[model samples]
Target: MIERRMNPHEGRSVINNGVKLRGSGFCIHMFYIRPVTYRGRIDKGQKIGEMLPMQRVYPGITSHVHVQNCNRFNVTRYL
Candidate 1:
């Protein structure tokens, strides 16, 4: 099932998803989509670089966070 953009621009760019991000002290719009393949749609979970997966696409007003803790004590133990 190939998902074509309603209004594709600059190739894969579609309409602004109502989300705005400020980068380098400037506001910019963002859009994500999957590419059509020779047979049909792309892989299910395979990410093609910076493009976001449709199944895991994030919307505005949503909050996401991640925390990583390195608790490797005695590194030589596993060596």
Candidate 2:
């Protein structure tokens, strides 16, 4: 798949995520599930999905993640 990421600096880059999309230009991100909560507690996989944010949180810092999705999509991963 053709995916683009527009950084805060107004810079953009395209990448291939192995999805089948031809000539489709758009921005994208690869999201996944973790086994913990924002407060650093282990959470059950079955119940964690209900608490994750539906929107993308771009944490500029690499030390920790602080983004929260406002919607309850019950999604475990996204890209």
Candidate 3:
């Protein structure tokens, strides 16, 4: 899997529970989840689909993640 943050200066960490992506201004995070193939047999344990925004992923968590041009986020333990 490959995770790329548009802004590398942002602070991020991954705890036991989930991944943490943080940034002050506009931040773009890209996640790449790959399938494990063995002997021509592919294994995709979880359902893969379009990636949703943080708000959609964690409903009721934050009504608004960004305020104007300033954006701050630290999502923890959401795996």
* Candidate closest to the true structure, highest TM-score: 1
Q: Is candidate 1 or candidate 2 better by TM-score?
A: 1
Model 2 lDDT-worst window of ten: 13-22
Over the stretch 1-79, how does candidate 3's per-residue lDDT look in tens digits?
A: 2122232223441210111233443333323211121112213453322322445435566332221112435444433
Q: Tell me how candidate 1 scores on lDDT.
A: 0.31
Off by over 4 Å in 1: 7-30, 33-39, 48-79
Candidates, ranked, lDDT: 1, 3, 2
Best by lDDT: 1
Clash pairs for candidate 1:
none
lDDT of 1 at 20: 26
TM-score sort, best first: 1, 2, 3
Clashing pairs in 3: 17-77, 18-77, 18-78
Give Cα distance to truth, residue 7, candidate 3, Å.
10
State the lDDT at 8 in candidate 2.
19
lDDT of each: 0.31, 0.27, 0.28
Model 2, span 34-77: residue lDDT tens: 32232222223433212223233444523232232323344467
